[model samples]
Every structure is written in C-alpha cells, then in structure tokens.
Target: MDLLRYVAFTDDPSGGNPAGVVLDAEHLDEPTMQATAAEVGFSETAFVVPRGGGRLDVRYFSPLAEVPFCGHATIATAVAHAHRHGVGELLLNTLAGEIAVSTSASPDGTVGATLVSVPPRTEPLADGDLAELLAALRWSAADLDPELPPRVAYAGAWHPVVAAATRARLAELDYDYDALATLMQRHGWTTVDLVHRESPTLFHARNPFPPGGVVEDPATGAAAAALGGYLRELGLAPAVLTVHQGYDLGRPSTITVTIPQAPGTGIAVTGTAVPYES
Candidate 1:
C-alpha cells in the first residue's frame, strides 16, 4: 500500500500538521490500518475506500487507536483526491457521521479543502469533571476565561473547550500527560482545546492529544470545528473566525471557520494542504 503524506492548514509542507493518507484501503483490515497508523507515527492517518457516486468511506486511526473523525486527515484525503480526480465536492462517510468536503485549486497552484462537520453539540462541564481537568493541567479556576466558560463540545469528536484568560496562561502548557490521558479516555475526549482569544474573530489554540499518543497537535481541525460549535451554542458566534495554531512548536497553521445562522448546523473548516516528502 502506498501511503501519501501531507501537511494540512498551511501551504508550506514544513508548517502544518502532517497526516498520512491511504487513498485506497479496500482490502486492508482494521488491524492493518491500526498498525500502519502506528508505523506512520502521525497523530492520525486516514484510510479511504471509494464507495462510488463521488463518495468515499474514510476511517481514521491514531498512533494508539482508532478515532471517530479527524479534521487534518480528512483535509489531506480530500486534497489528495482532488489531485487525482480533480477539485470538486465529495461526500465522506466517517465513523462519526457524514461530512461534505469541497476542494479547489488556487491561483498559486495550491489545493485547499473545506470540510463541513457533522451537526455539532455542546454540554456543560460538570463541576467534578472540571476540577479533574483543571487538576491534570495544573490550572486553577482563576486561569479560565469567564467569558468563554468551560464545556465539552462535539463536532465529530468530543473536546473539552477551555479558554485561557491570558495568552501567557495558554502558552504555559506543562501538564500531567498520563493523568489527563486517563481522564480523556474515561470521557472519550480526543483533545483538550486550550484557547485564548486574540480578538473577536481571531483565536490562538493548543490541543493536548494524549489519547492519540501525541503530546500536542500542531493544528487540530476537529477541535477547531468543536470550538465553532461551542461559540455558536453560547451565542458568541462570529460570522467568520480564524484559528492560529502551532506557533509554539514552529509549525504554524491557519484554520478558518464559518458559522451559519442556523443552529445545530455543520461548521465549515477550511485549510490548505501540501505534500510532505515522508
């Protein structure tokens, strides 16, 4: 099987989050997919099988296990398909649900993909859960942004959305990885969305993805979608928003989200992908 590597959310290969894409995995079993993901060593790898009628069945596997959905991997797969089949709209059936993705070629010869996530939802974080999460991160209640509050949000996957009051608080990411991993495992959380608001339409984020065997994700499309949902549900939605991520680790990525007026609708996450030599 040929594994195609791509970095999503940036035009430069050295900038975005890298993901492995298997364009065709019709004959591959679950074990093979899991093993391949581990070997690839990216946070997640997408296995795609053509289902005809411009539809593809996609499965995402992390280094440690399978995940319901992955934004960066989906972006990579869509861009790869566009390269082979031409830029257009495609329907993807993921473990989470159906996602619609559209790809286009830019004037600069770059391919970009925008994925509409499954209908997202959010639930208030229980006090006990919040306490545990805070303890794991070594953060006190004072560190949180009261404006954003805290909640568990879901688009394709679950993420605890925590907003830091200051950029400095968000940047100091020392945390108990194992403890947080265990907590996330129990709650079925894919990542901890640690964010700081730079402006009404601009945000900076860091994602702790111990569940995927990655200490941190350079750019997280799934979490970005969840954040959009969280904002809309809380009546803080913006017409358009930009998420800036990966600067701390040097692989900067940019994700743009567009939220519709209708409630419980899919959140659109757009990003560019570049081929990686790996």
Candidate 2:
C-alpha cells in the first residue's frame, strides 16, 4: 500500500501534473482505492494490481469519483514501475480498454513513457450542446477557431475539443466552474480540451476538469490523445505534433503525440516523469 507520487510530462518534479501511484494494490477494494485517491488530493491517482506476465490491472480515481481512464496517471505509473522494476513494455487493463505502454531511460537517465491509447473516435457536438458549453465557458462562437471544428472525441475517455481562435483567448480562462461541471456531467465528458494551434505541428492547450472536482488539469494525456484522433480524422494532423500545456498555471508540461496513418487506430502519447517532492 505504498503511495508514490510522481509528476508526469516534465523532468522537473514541480513542472508537470502530479499523480499518486500505488504500484501494488492487490488487496484494496474499490472503496479503499477511492479513499486513498481522495487523500492524495491530486487530480487523479492510479492503483495498479499486477496480473502477472507483464500485465497489470489499473484503475484511475479522481478525488471525487472513479474515471474510466487517465493519461497522466498512466504515465506516472509506468515510470514508477520502471524505476522499481525495469524499463519495458506493459499491458494495462483499464475500465476504458486495454492500453499498451512502453518505458525507456534516456542518456541522461530520465525515465519516459509512451502509451498507445485504445482506438479513438470522434462525434459531432450537437448545436444545442455547443451553445450550452460556450455559455458555461463564457465564450461565444466567434471565439472558436474556424479550422478546428468542435467535436466530442474519445480515446480512453471522452473530451470536448474546442479550439480557440487566438492564443489570447486560450490564455484568458475564466469559466463558470459549477455550470461547466454540470454541462460536462450531462455529456459524460472527462475534460474540456481548450486548445489553440500555434503552427501546423505545434499547439497549446488547457483542460477544464470540473467533473473531477479540479478547476483545471496541468497536463492531460487522455485529452491530447483524443485531440490527435480528431485531427487525424479530419486530415489535419501532420504525422506528429507537440502540445504545450500548464504554462499558465506555472507548472509547464510538454506532451508529444504521434498520429498513425491507418484509420481507427490508437494514438501514441509520450512524456517524461519524475519523482515529485511536493
């Protein structure tokens, strides 16, 4: 029942998103896991139960509830396992689906993990839902990017992909927390992926995660994967892309996404993780 803390997407411990990792939680039940996650007080915590033969059963829990999948926690868990065991591939069974993760150590001895999300898909955002969501965020249709249309995307979890027309719009994030949470709950969305495309291969993002009882997520892997899927589906992705997030919060994070040419395949998200002191 050792609770390990690690920050994902940054080598600096204080820069990325912090996640609680229980490497071995074979005996803990759902209630205990939920309580432990709440006690950790991070955006999300990962509970890993070894199923033997390089396979692990993983569960993700936010402070308030259990989520189907979590990208940052998954990255943290993989890095933690690599530190304790060794760098290699792991098969993770999550509520969303099976995810494949590979861990490696760089020349500088930095541990990095790349996770291949389950096959991703996208659905159109209904006009009514879009109006309500914009109202919640205090944003109008004019604020949205004309190129990247609004859509509900899913990799391991669901996220509404909203692209801001300008970087300034993305930077100024003052949203109705309660209203956004209610809208997200109604749509079963894990987070609202607010993004602004800087270049063809570069982007900046912010994630509002009120459904998880958090105002915002510093780095969101699942949402990034979903965004990749949405881009690939629309023929807007250029093989690989970099997403910079958490800068507004002073905890900068970098996420790299690899898009496959094949249709209906998993998206790969890679990032580094380190032991967190705070």
In model 1, residue pairs whose N, Cα or C atoms come closer than 3 Å (at least 3 residues apart or on different chains), thus clashing, are: none
Note the residue pairs that clash in candidate 2.
none
Tens digit of lDDT per residue, candidate 2, span 1-278? 89999999999988999999999899999999999988998999999999988799999999989999999999999999999999999999999999999999999999999999999999999999999999999999999999999999999999999999999999999999999999999889999999999999999999999988899999999999999999999999989999999999999999999999899999999999999977
* Count of clashing pairs, candidate 1: 0
How well does model 1 score by local distance difference test? 0.95
Q: Give per-model TM-scores.
A: 0.99, 0.99
Which candidate leads the pack in lDDT? 2
**Model 2 RMSD vs true structure:** 0.6
* Residue 255, model 1, lDDT: 98
Off by over 4 Å in 2: none
- lDDT of each prediction vs. the true structure? 0.95, 0.96
